[model samples]
Target: MKRIKNYFTIIAALIFFSGLADAQRSPQRAPQSKAIASSEDQCLFNGTYRIDVTESDRLYSVVEDARSSVPVRDQQQFFRDLSTRLTPPDMLAIECQGTRVTVGSSRAGKITYLADGINRRERLPDGSFVSSKITLGVDSLTFVSSGKAEDNVNVAFESLEDGRRLRVTRRIDAQQLPEPIVIQTLYDKISAAAEWNIYDGDRVAGKMGSAQPGAPPESNRAADALRSEFAIWIEATNRRDIAQQMRFYMDELQAFYLTRNTPKRAVRLEKERIFGSARSVDIRAGEPEIVFQNGGRTAI
Candidate 1:
């Protein structure tokens, strides 16, 4: 009887210890992930969004009705430009990641909204990483109205991933009606602003006789013409038009050196002269900057 009782006691002790051990070895509960939600997430930087501009049927009709108010040439450009900018069916999904906004139409894989913004990092399927930073601000706004015309109106943004800070502004006419009506008006205003920004930048860079920073001390006409020709030549090459490529240099040589030499010779000589005077020529997205190769190349 004593031995049986002792055996029972030993079994109970072992079972209790085993239960405690199992409890201790169990996995712990993970912390819940947090999400930042806001009423204004539609315009958040890097926030994915779907906007339906076509939902406002009345507004669309109104714009169409007033199309005749604009001049014939202006109307042609306006409709063409607007058609290119806005997606069909009035629905557009945009991912505001970094300085870029990847816009999609009704379905997926139709990315079109590429604007000036900070660079982003993309991970490849093979595990490699690529980073592209947008130089200009992605969330810039310029407002104009009958009474008010302010340039910068920065707004605050909080990063959901890393808690980084971002700023933007809603540039629109202050006297505009309520949100429903103003959304349409604001969309037009903002689109114009973006287009104008790009146009102005390109125009300034493309204008003949425009001075580059740190270029050789040549006359404005010579340097500007050379740059303008170079731009055309590069564009022609990119298009892969052999005739255009030939004509670019031919025209340049005739205009600058007063020579009707072969394309190869003209190109070689032009390159030599340009490089001889250039310490360093920086070809970038913005304005081209040059440094003298020989002496100090002051910007002309």
Candidate 2:
């Protein structure tokens, strides 16, 4: 009877300790998750980005408005600004594993989420913030009052079919990264001396106009073909092959080269052949003419 009582007592103590340990661990896990997850207020980034509609092209304007608020003059500038957004500082999220944020059609308009990071913010009619940036794992994808925090709020979908429109909100604080470890390891390759491993060879290969053999250059195959053709053209020109040169140039360029008049040469006189005063030689632009003292005394 005493043994049974002792066993029950022991089991109760184990349960009590496990519960206490769980309570201690739960708080730690919450902060770690919160660190990656931003609040609605924290995620709320608001600023006026300009978009230029030159000739009121709906297709172009729609595409421009769907991606970003940054002002763009033409399609070229549009690509440039979008490239910037895809990079650092301006972007809200990096590659979040198991966390995806997308803008597309759904039953309740377009919805964006942090998936499992931070609670999202509510969007107002004027695109004002109702709360903080959505934390990850907060599966709240509703715009009930236009007052609660939302991930995708005030977003104007350019077209439901193409989804080309752009609406850039404030960039999230992804710039805040944890301190890098100084210790050398296989995983910390980019931060350590390993960055130089491929970079040094790449630099050399670029200067020499070839790849390092082990790794292919990032440029397309078309560029390599063009470079090879240029080399062959240079070689043919150095050899002075009329047939090869004719093959290298097009019809108009070949005619232009052949018809251009060659300049005539002047009389040759040695430095010692002339005597008396020196005279300046005036020559026109694009003409090659040399003048120097012919005699030991001076050339006239």
- Model 1 segments more than 4 A misplaced: 1-60, 67-90, 112-300
State in Å the error of residue 157, model 1. Answer: 15
Q: Would you estimate the TM-scores of all the predictions?
A: 0.20, 0.18
Model 2 accuracy (lDDT, Cα): 0.25
- Alpha carbon lDDT of each predicted model: 0.31, 0.25
Question: In model 1, what lDDT does residue 112 have?
Answer: 28
Query: Candidate 1 residues 1-300, lDDT tens each?
Result: 332233223222221111112212223332222221221333344322222232333333332333233345455444333222222212222344432333332222333222332233444234543332222132331111111111111112222223122222221211111111111311111120112122122223223122234333354455466567778766654554445656644333432222233356666555556456666554434344221222323321
Query: For this target, which candidate reaches the highest lDDT against the unseen true structure?
Result: 1
What C-alpha root-mean-square deviation, in Å, does candidate 1 show against the real structure? Answer: 28.9
Model 2, backbone clash pairs (residues 3+ apart or across chains), number? 36
